[model samples]
Target: MTHYFSWLKNPDNRLKLLILAFVITLFPFVAVSFFAFPTTDDYCHTLAVKEMGYWGYQVHYWKTWSGRYIGTLISATQPLAYDSYLGYKLAPIVLILLYVHASLKFAGAITGDKLAKWQTYLLAFLLVFVLIAELPVVSGYFYWYTGYYYTVADIGTLYLLAYLFRNYSKLSSRNIVVLALGIILLVGMNEYTLVWLVVLSGALFFFGSVVTRKLQVKYLVLSAVALVFGVLSVTAPGNAARAESGLYPTPLKYNLLFSIKNSLAWQIHNFAKIAPALCVLALVLIPIACQLFKNKGDFKFLRAHPALSILVFVGCLYLSYFPSYWSIAEPPNLRGQCVITFWTLIGWTYNVFVLTFWALEKGYMKPVEPGKPVAWVVGLYFFFLFTGNFNYRSAWSDLLTGRAARFNKEMHERTALVLNTREEQVYVPKLKNVPYTILIVNDETDPAWASVEVNNGCAEWFFKKKFFYK
Candidate 1:
């Protein structure tokens, strides 16, 4: 046992082990992506783009539906736009890789060379795994074509943050231009992310100027760019049209109060939902925290204002909820919750590291050593992840039990039927095997149901015939 522990202690060996675990953890999710199919909005947006032309579709959506210019453009050009099933299957894989790349970049930027490459990759992998595994709706953020743009935009934000954090003090004029362009695109992608970036930039300005007494012109300029674009997005004529449609009916006061209340409740719920994984993450971070503390000078600012930092973290969470509630007069939808889950996990992990380092600095806890404790915790994490976590377990079940395959076959059959049918109106049977990892909104027999009408309308637009579900 001691010999085995010694072997695992080698950094290279540890990286290899972690890489293997990451691949294993990610396999089922990626495998099942082959079975994914576009849902309601996917058909709608693709059809709209085809009918209006790409640029025309953007203008139409801007005038009628949403102010998310970049999001609308991306949605219009999804794999389905070109009628490519193979591309559709490949979309999730691309997204997963992009997320890992962004995470690694951000990790490296933040740690500089204080941590080895393996350590940076370890932290990045941990972040990616937690975000993917604990998402409130995996299909919404990953599989659904219309929704995954948000994830893309979020990843873009991460990359932008990494660039800024790495180059802020010595940004070239070219870098500034790149930063501005990135912010413009990011704000146009989604209102939720726009709000997030704005809040984050504001916090940076406050901390840098007020607390540290060091003014950063780059932060101020970026904040102004975000605010300007944010106003332009919010004030779009389509926003008022969307509001008048009675989609979001909650009053302003109620929206404000509920956003705050639900923000706290959801964070607590998510924490409990992934408690075991979090425990493992906390244990994993202990050694990393100790390394950071030893190599980097004391993170004095991080520890100096613990109370303020907690408030800032909670405030960020509240802001995440506020934009969705204010827009829709309700909590964010499952797709939007992807952002919530993301920030919560990130905030929680960072807090864990900071608290651990603080404790070590204060002599309240002994210095951490990566050995038996981390190994045991990792084993428990994998056990809980594969057997207990609904997200991963459901994914494995879908792939192993042939549910995903059956679902894929059925969808392909439906597509064939739709394409071959000559009738103006067609009746199709409901899907029998719906995979848990895929979003399936079963069509209602009653056409009066808004969902049924929308689904039938989009299908008719796409297939040139009405579809009825029985």
Candidate 2:
């Protein structure tokens, strides 16, 4: 344990560890993309966007924009939603690429090393693992393209924190102001993300002193400015109205152990059928032990560094209390307390505990040759986490172009039908330009779609009443 603690102090080794951390982060998304879209959330959000196209927003932006805006302006200006599903699909890719680039840079900052060509390959593999851990959720989101924005928001916060940490020493007045501005922008874009962003930011301020004893007054001022700006942005009338348009005032639980258990269980259940061996090793048994025994800090470190303890405590508290939200107000609830806990704890165990300790205990205290076997061992460890899984590959391909196009085509035809239009357009909430537009269009192609029928009164009659359009 002493050896490991000693190893963490070495800046060079810390760089390698940072590279290792990124691999852990990226691999899960890559692996899961092969199985399913991240979640139906992406499609659902797209539906909202489609609704925006078909009708104007009801309460929040009622006077500002309507569905006509979507058809006329948005489609023309942004490639995100255009004439076809392909355009909609490619829209989120740009944000995701930005996220990936930001994350890579962030990882490099923490590791304090340039990612070599070989390291970059490993980085890709690691992304696969990160995506896998996320599993079906990532692929499910990939289908509609919009879901990626939610994820990008989440990951973007982490990258921003990494940026702050990496540039902790060299933060100038300009840099601090820019970071403050960035936080403000992020808050306006996504409130839930801002909540986690603040939590992470607080964690950095706490853990930072542990790594670097240099605490500058400027850093404190900058953080304060950022927090204030973030609050203002989030509280902006427009942003708040948007948030209220969705559900709110949900409670959050901070029970770490329980949340971790729940997260592990869900991941296992989601992936066990697809990748049993990997699931058993990574999600089920190994992580259990890793969380249970290995993460415990020794007396010297734990006792001496009361600040670290407090940071962990406060972070856990914030994480527990934070309400889980999605991109849309009526967004599908994926905010499992346990899932968040597992992700948080894993980062703790890997980056904060394992990698940090390994660096300190080994020759990290003194500069060692770059060819250390430990680096190789770390590389292999991440490789296994990323590769050796194949479920999501099929799932992703199925969603990308096929499903969206099919739905749009069917919807177009159904809306074209008089019976469909009368049934769907009746008594439904009207949008701006596309008032009384058909809500759902179905056909004989699938019994499911065929079973849905509507009448002149907009009364949706499902086959055997199995489903309701409303």
Per-prediction CA RMSD (Å): 3.2, 11.7
Candidate 2 residue-wise lDDT, 1-470, digit = tens = 78985996676666677566555444433332232211122232333445565333332232332111112222223222333434443444544455567646644543344344434333333443454444434332332232333444445555665666556657788778777766655543334444555654555565555567877455566456556655654444554454444335433233445455554444344334434323322322222222322323321222224345445544543433333222221222333222333234334323433333343445353323333455455556545644443423333333443543344444444334424443333222221111001111223212112222222121123111222232
- Among these predicted structures, which one has the highest lDDT? 1
What lDDT score goes with residue 179 in model 1? Answer: 87
lDDT of each: 0.75, 0.40
User: What digit string (tens of lDDT, one per residue) describes model 1 on residues 157-248?
Assistant: 77986787577557787887888899889889887787777777677667767776888776688778888888888888887788777655
